[model samples]
Target: MTYEIALNKAWDKIAALASSKKYTVKYFTDIYEVRISDRMMLSISSDTPASEDIAILVLHYLTGFLKYGYNPKEEWISFKDIKGGQSYYPAYQENTIKPILEKFKEKTDDLISYLTESLEGRIVKGGDVTVELPTFSDVYIRMVLWHGDDEFAPEVTILFDRELTEIIPSEDIAVLLFNLAKRISDEL
Candidate 1:
C-alpha cells in the first residue's frame, strides 16, 4: 500500500484504541509523541501531522506498542537476525551503513564525540568506536565502527534490541536506520 493509505490505516487503528482503559493507564494520554531523531519529533494525533514516511513509522511503532506493550529483552542482535531482515539487508547496507562509514572513516574521534555529546550515546566496548544510542524511552541502537587500514575498508554495524521487531516491522526498521544514518552524516 501507499504510504498515505498505510498511515491513515495505522492512525485509524490507534484511534480506535485511544479510549481503552489499557491505553489511558499505560500511556496516560491519547496523543503519543515519538522521537524520530534529536532534531525531529513525531506526534501521533489528528491535529499533528508528519511527513508520510515518518508518520508511517511512528504510527506503526505506536500501534505495535499499544498492541504488544513494551518489553525489551535487552539482548542485541544484527539486522540480519531480525525476521525478514535479510531481504532488506542490501538496501540497509547501502542506505544506512555506507553513509555512516563514509562520513566517519577519516574522523573516528569526531564521530565518537558527536555520539556521546550530541546524541547522548554511551561508549561501549567491541569496536574501535562503539556506542549505544537511545532512540526512545528504553529503546536503543548500538553502533559499532571500525576504522579502515590500508588493506581493509571502514565498516559500520548496527544492532537492535531483540524485542524491537515486536514494536517495529522489518521494513520500517530499515527506514528507521536510514533516517538515523542520515541524521548522523548530515552536516552538524
Candidate 2:
C-alpha cells in the first residue's frame, strides 16, 4: 500500500486506540506532541508542518506500539537476532552504516556533536562514538560509530533491543534505518 494509505490506516488505529490505550497527547506551541515514553517522544509541526516522511514514521511507530504493546526486555541485540535479519544484514550495513562511515570518516567527533545537538543522542562507551537513540516509546536504537584514521576504514553498527522484533517488521526496520541516516545526514 502507498504510504498515504498506510498513514490513514494508522491514523484510524491511533484514534481508535487513543482513548482506550490512554496515550499522552499534548500541544506545545505550534507543535503537537505525543509522548510515547519518558525518553521517546514524537512531534508534528503545526504550522508549515514536518515532511510526510516524519509524520509517517510517527504514525507507524504509534500504530506498532498500540498493536503490540510496550514491554521491552531492556537487552540490546544486533539485527541478526531479529527474524529474517540475517538475510537483510548486508542491506542494513550498506544503507545505514556505510554512509555514516563515509560521511564521518575522520570526523567522528563532528558526527557525535551533531547527533547530540540535533537528535538528542546520548553518548556511550564502546565505539569511538556510540549514541543511544530513542526511536519509539520502548524502542532505543544504539548506533556505534568507530572512527578510523588513514590506516583503517571507519565502521558503523546499528543495534536494537531484542523486543523490537516483536513489534516492528524487518522491512520497516530497513526504512527506519534509511530515514534515520537521512536525518543524521541532513544535520551534517
Q: List where candidate 1 sits over 4 angstroms from the true fold.
A: 20-49
lDDT of 2 by residue, 1-188 (tens): 24667656656666666644234332212233543222223445433343455555665666667678768787878877778888988887787777777767756678888777766678887787789876664467788877667898678888877777776677777777777787667667
lDDT of 1 by residue, 1-188 (tens): 45767766776776665444232111212243543222223345554545678767666776777788779897889999988888878888888888888778767788888878877789889787789887755678899888868998888999988888888888888887888887778843
Summing lDDT over every window of 10 consecutive residues in candidate 2, give the lowest-scoring window: 21-30
Displacement of the residue 82 alpha carbon in candidate 1, Å:
1.6
lDDT to native, each model: 0.72, 0.66
Best by lDDT: 1
Pick the TM-score winner: 1
Checking candidate 2 for backbone clashes, the offending pairs are none
Error of 2 at 165 (Å): 2.0
